[model samples]
Target: MAKFIINGGKKLSGEIKVSGSKNALFPIFAASLLTEQPCRISNVPEIVDKQVMVHLLADLGVQMNVSPHEVLITAANINKTDLNPELTSKLRGSVVLLGALLARMKRVTMSFPGGDSIGKRPIDSHLQAFEALGAITQANGVIEISAEKLVGNKIILEESSVTATENAILAGAMAEGQTVIKLAAMEPHVQQLCEFLNKMGAKITGIGTTTINITGVPKLHGAEIDLIPDSNEAASFITLAAATKSTVTVTGINPEYLDDFLLKLKNMAVNFEVGKDFIEVNAPTVDYQAIKIQGGLYPKLASDDIPAMAILATQAVGKSTMNEWMYENRLGYATELMKMGASVEAVDSHNVIFTGPTPLKGDKMTSSDIRMGITLVIAALVAQGQSEIEGVEHIDRGYENLEERLSKLGAEIRRA
Candidate 1:
């Protein structure tokens, strides 16, 4: 087991280059299985979640090589259609392979996926999309699916679920006709996936909207794609700078994708400058007004960001509220924050209220998930005295070389 022994009250300052999107690359990696040629992806993050994902792909007979910043994947010799049960249980992203497998070999079997238990993430949309595309689905302890001939049609997703929508798009890419997806997820990562598929010869329009159109292609050729910087990680650093009232610049980020979070930062009179590809945040140690935020679908705050937002709320002068509608279990992180002397109330599963300007005193804490794990580290950074944060592995599953990166910005952190 690894731990982060953090001496808090350090003001972080300097530039940190963000990594590629874990959310974007995982699905893209799964989508590569749809093609026989090699698909190369650059700007890949070196994190544990991706390692788990890569292992799952390797088990399914996909050939790949990983460098620091790129991965070349070729699926020419795929020897399996069913996913490894143990491997799939380790990654939620494994569920995405349902569409790619059904598209390539027309059969797939897998048990339920396990990821961060932050919410009730159902794959009904994925199964429904496959069934709409002419696949048959049978659900038992393990789910089994097979399709004779996929006939593309209109798919209307009940919720703006990102992975389910990507599954639909991957399966629809090879269907016999046009497939129109309504009420689709329009998150930037989803658009990036669409762009990647388009580069590989799939016709997809409606880049950032609720309605998306896809025309099936006989075959897709391999293409090299560079994933955009991880906006979620970017949000984490931005909140860290603000929570500690430091001046830090995050580079290689898409300011356009950060609108949902930046608006809230601006409302609190937090200081920041946005460039085309970067955002620099500087938080003064003085008091700021409390604010209310709601996390939701694309063009809005993402649920993964709620933990960081809660940390930001803790630095304000008065009471602040964060309403999370995406996940029922997300607010559980507040218990750990309270151990560091934060004044937080978990109002049921979907809401949390933070009474601000609490002088956090660092202490021992456990990590529940990836996002919340990083949030705890951020809180420890600003908390007075020392704190031992276990579950550093959870933080490692997302952020790459987190201690090294923060050390460059003057954080007193060491990995144990």
Candidate 2:
């Protein structure tokens, strides 16, 4: 197993470019299967989850020409419908392939998908959405979905789940009639997928809104697109700079996509400036104010960012409470933070309280999930001594070349 050894108290100063969206790339990759023509996508990140998706698509006879920054995928000769369980089980994004494959091949069977173990993330919404789209679903140990001919219908999602919304959009794009999705996810990545689909002959509209309309077409063709920079990554970098009182700039990101997080930073008295396509954060106040973080749908604080905010809270002046009702185990990292001398109380599975200006002392810890892994790295970078973090593979699943990138920013971090 790989570990990240860090010598804390280094003030990171430099510009770091944000990577391509991990959430957006999965649906786009799965959508490529909708066409036989070659689809080229640029600005692809070399994350572990992406490699897992590439392997999964390859197992289905899809050919890919992968480079450092892009992938040219040709799914013209796909020969299988049952997903390889080994690959599928390692990536939660593999679940999006169900709607894509069912639309292209009329059937799909695979075991449950997996990724971060932050909480009980069920696929009930996805299965329910597929059923609404004229597909027959069988759920036991293995999940099977098939449709003789997918006919469009009105789908009101049980929850605004991002992956569930992507699946519905993928299937709805090629479903026989007009499909309307209500209470859909309005995430930037979700909107990016809809835009890519439209370029490939899918008549989709009302993007970046809760209600989406898809006019199904008989077939789709190949298209090329560049992915948006990852807003979550931008938020993480800003959190790191603020926690360590560093001056850092994150470029290649759309500031509009990160309004919620940026607003939170402003509320906490973190000095930051947003430009056309970049964010430069200066050192925060010596005694910053603590504020509550309430997680909700888009236009609100994302649950994925809660851990980073929690790290910031440790350096704030008062008690900061985080309410993340979306995921039961979102606060699962509190114990790990406590080990590093943070004053944290896991109020429940969904809520946590952090009290601060606490001086963090480094300690050995284990990562539990992707966001938690990076959150610990930020904590370690801001701590008083050396810290060692195990299970960095979880970190690699999201951020690409994290240690190297942070090293460029002058962090004393190395892989061992």
Candidate 3:
């Protein structure tokens, strides 16, 4: 495993463009299977997860033309319905294919999906949604799902799970009848998937809302699309700028998607300006105030961004409370931060209390997960001494060329 050797206390400046959304691209990749024609997607980030996703698609006999930041996938002839167990286990996002494959071939078999060890991320929602859409599931260590003919039905998700909603939408897109989804996830990535499906001739309405309707078509045609800029990545850089009191402008960001996060930054008195497609963080306020932060469903702070917000809280003047009920171990990074001299108390599995204006000194740390890894990188950038962060692979899964990108922004970070 590669490690990041970062010399902290360096102010970062210059404009850094956020990469295409990893979350958005995964579903788009899976959705390509709905059509036999070629689907070309631009703005594809070269992340490890994308690599894994492409491999999985290739294993299914989809012909692909992949380049830096671009991919053209032609699922002209898919030879396999069973997902490769080893490849499928490496990526949690692989679960989205369950719906996509079912829509195309009506049969898919796979073992449990794997991802970061944040907490329990169950696929019960996916299976339940499929069952509601007239698919039968058999599970005994491995899962075998098949549908004779999918007929859409009203599905009220167990929770507003993004992937589950994507799965339901994918299956509903090609089902025989109209499918109604209530209490669906309205995340930006979910919206992107909906829009992309519509572009491919799937009739979907009530986008950006809890309730969505899909009129199933017999088949979906391939279409080209551009992936949206990753909001989580934009949030990470914004936090990095504020944590180090740097002047960094993050471009290619849709400010609308980051409203809650930006509001939190504004409340903290962090100096930042939001443009049509950019957010520039100037020198941070001298005495930033601590604020309460909660992670919830969309329009609220995203659970993925909670870790970066926690790092920002560490530099605030007063105590800040972090409530992340979405994942049990999302705040596991608090202990690693404590090692770097931050005042942190793990109040409970779901809550954390941070007391700040603490000068962090570099310490050895592990990256644990994607969000946790980037959070540590931001923390290390502002720390006093050099820090060695292991598990760079986890960071690469989400952020594309992160060390190289941050280095160009004047950060003294190097992959070792």
Candidate 4:
């Protein structure tokens, strides 16, 4: 039970470089199982989720050379087709391996995957997509998926689930014929996976759209790829800057990926500048009007960023609302914020109303999930007095070396 100790009322000023997207790397790493050639991926973040993925890959006999900045994976000699429930339960990203294993070995046995206890994130889409690819699926205590030959077909996901769409893509990349996916998730990370597979010789088109067409190739050759900077992490620092009324310059960002969040920042009257690879934010002296945040799909405010926006709303001039229609437990930290003197109320399981500019007082809190965990940290960093946040493990799953990075930016925070 590690904790983060923070001395509040520090104005975070200085430049901080965000790591590569952890979310982007998860599915791509699993998708690497589709190819026999050595795949080189750079700009990987060193986080708990990545380590868990590497551990899962090791169990499957994929030789990996992992470092702080990059990862080289060659699944040419995989010996196992089954992933254990223990490792898979650690992170939900493990479910993405289903399509890859089916693509390569044509058989896979596993239990239900797990990650955050946010809600009932069902893998029905993953199994449904696999069945669409001509695979036979069974369900007992364990799920057994097998196929004689993967034949591509059209798949229209039920709800544009990201991992389900990714599973279909991974399996479709190696299937026999053309695979058409309609109502696919058009997230930046999903697009990144499409681009990576294309570089690996899979002909994928209509990226960043609702419809994705994939032409299955016989074999995929390994290629080098770089991950895009994490927009969520970039947005985290920008929210901190505004909450503390400080100046922060975050480097290593692609401005286009963060257009929606930037628009909301502007609407909230937070002065900001975007460059080729950087975002500089300056907080105004007076609190600004409330801004409604719709935590929907990509090109919209993502669900992961909902908590941070709620934290920003606590210091806003008027009433602000955050609606996370995706997950029921996304507002778990709202009660925690109330402990810190924030006028935030969980209006429903999926929505929260924040009234500000309420003065926040530091207190003891715990991380509920990755997004909510960091949001609490940002609130604690700006609150009056000392704040201790339990559950560093949850925070480490997403952000890499958060305490050290924020420390460099003048935040008096340390792991304890």
Q: What is the lDDT of residue 351 in candidate 4?
A: 83
Lowest lDDT 10-residue stretch of candidate 3: 280-289
lDDT of each: 0.89, 0.91, 0.92, 0.89
- Candidate 2 TM-score, true structure as reference: 0.99
What C-alpha root-mean-square deviation, in Å, does candidate 2 show against the real structure? 0.9
lDDT score for residue 271 of model 4? 79
Q: How many backbone clashes does candidate 4 have?
A: 0
Which one wins on lDDT?
A: 3
2 versus 4: better TM-score goes to: 2
Cα lDDT of model 2 by residue, 172-244, tens digit: 9999899999999999999999999999999999999999999999999999999899888888998999899
Per-residue accuracy of model 3 over 1-416 as CA lDDT, tens digit each: 89999999988889999999999988999999999999999999889999999999999999989998999999999999999999988899999999999999999999999999888987888888899999999878988899999998999999999999999999999998889999999999999999999999999999999999999999889899999999999999888898899999999989999999888888999999989999999996568899999878899889988898888889899999999878897787899999999999888999999998899999999988999999999999999999999998999999998988999999899988
RMSD of 3: 0.8
Q: What's the lDDT of the predicted structure labeled candidate 2? A: 0.91
Q: Lowest summed-lDDT stretch of 10 residues in model 4?
A: 280-289
TM-score of each: 0.98, 0.99, 0.99, 0.98
Displacement of the residue 191 alpha carbon in candidate 3, Å: 0.7
User: Model 1 off-target regions past 4 Å?
Assistant: none
